[model samples]
Target: MSTIVIKRSQAVWQDRTRAYTAWVDGKAVGRLEHGASLSVPVGAGEHEVQMRIDWCTSPALSVSVPVGGTVELECGPNANALLALLYITLWRHRYIWLKPATTE
Candidate 1:
């Protein structure tokens, strides 16, 4: 089996108040709190993952994990204030941003 590590940081003070739910292949995996992370074991192959908070969600991300390998993901709020506001009111933009971690 492979592993997937999902993480989120309390980058913005406002975000510190909420924890996001991590999902893999449409199944709820666990909660990711600010500055915290979780690891889930899965069969080696492709999967779809995302994060959600309240009514907001991150775009589904497709990832492939090799046997005994790990895939890392990071979730956070948009940095742009204007876009952040839209994230609250527009479903299209109402999502946290999830991307591959830049560093291990």
Candidate 2:
């Protein structure tokens, strides 16, 4: 089972549109509109974590986690450093979250 823990520092729009997207291993996984918390089934093993909202110039941010491990990402409002943005974009954001690998 793969779970994503998100902590939002801002509120959704008045229309109740969060306009956020999460990607697991380069593939979009879950979409949260009016909600802040999201849980979804993720592929086990090492995978890339990416997320971004509207008005956000930069792409998704990432980190790395172990399999079967639950990772939490906090969304804060700020302009990241130039170098960081460039590096992150190369990896398509970051290298966050690690899902458990399945054994045959």
Candidate 3:
């Protein structure tokens, strides 16, 4: 088995109290809270992951995991307080961000 680990950031001013739904291969697996990390097990190979709340969702993140390997990802709302309105009204689907963790 392989693991998809997702770490969510803490956004004090944006959706701080809400939880994002974690999706793997288009199925809702669990709720990922702010500033929390979750691990979802999957068969080895490629998969698509997403984090979303209602109409707001991050771009899909594609990953390949070897047998017994792990893929780490980070996600959060892309909209800050100032950009929240714009994101809500314009790019609802891009309101969140999901990507491979490089900056840590």
Candidate 4:
């Protein structure tokens, strides 16, 4: 098995709404906030790792972790874009769900 560590850096903006969902092959594995760290279990081999915020998704990182080793991911600037996209997407989803009831 392999271990993965995700690290987030602080943004200058006061916004704390930024949260990233970590995915493996389009499946969500876990989530972490900006400046937070999350550890995940992985298998040895080349794996596609992704981070998504709202509707925007980060470029998939091809990571190869050795057996019983660790891989550290530094989630940086792109976080802002990721977060913005996610917020808009979620808002749309919420509107779509809530509007139907009120309109009826």
Highest-lDDT candidate: 3
**Per-residue lDDT for 92 in model 4?**
31
TM-score of 4: 0.69
Give a tens-digit lDDT track for model 2, residues 1-104. Answer: 65556544443332144445666677777765544656655545555655655423224445455567666665433334444454345543332222222235
Against the hidden reference, what TM-scores do the models get? Answer: 0.88, 0.50, 0.93, 0.69
Residue-level lDDT of model 1, residues 4-102, one tens digit each, is 998886776647778989999999999988889999899999999988888778889999999999999888876356566677767534468888988
What's the lDDT for all of these models? 0.84, 0.49, 0.90, 0.62
**Model 3 regions lying over 4 Å from their true place:** none
Mark the 10 consecutive residues where model 2 has the least summed lDDT.
94-103
List clashing residue pairs in candidate 4: 53-86, 54-86, 55-85
Better of 1 and 3 by TM-score: 3
**Which pairs clash in model 2?**
44-100, 45-99, 45-100, 45-101, 62-94, 62-95, 62-96, 63-95, 63-96
Q: What tens digits encode model 3's per-residue C-alpha lDDT throughout 1-104?
A: 89999999888778888999999999998898889999999999999999999888888888998899999999999998678888887888789999998863
In model 4, which runs have C-alpha deviations exceeding 4 angstroms?
79-104
Ranking by lDDT: 3, 1, 4, 2
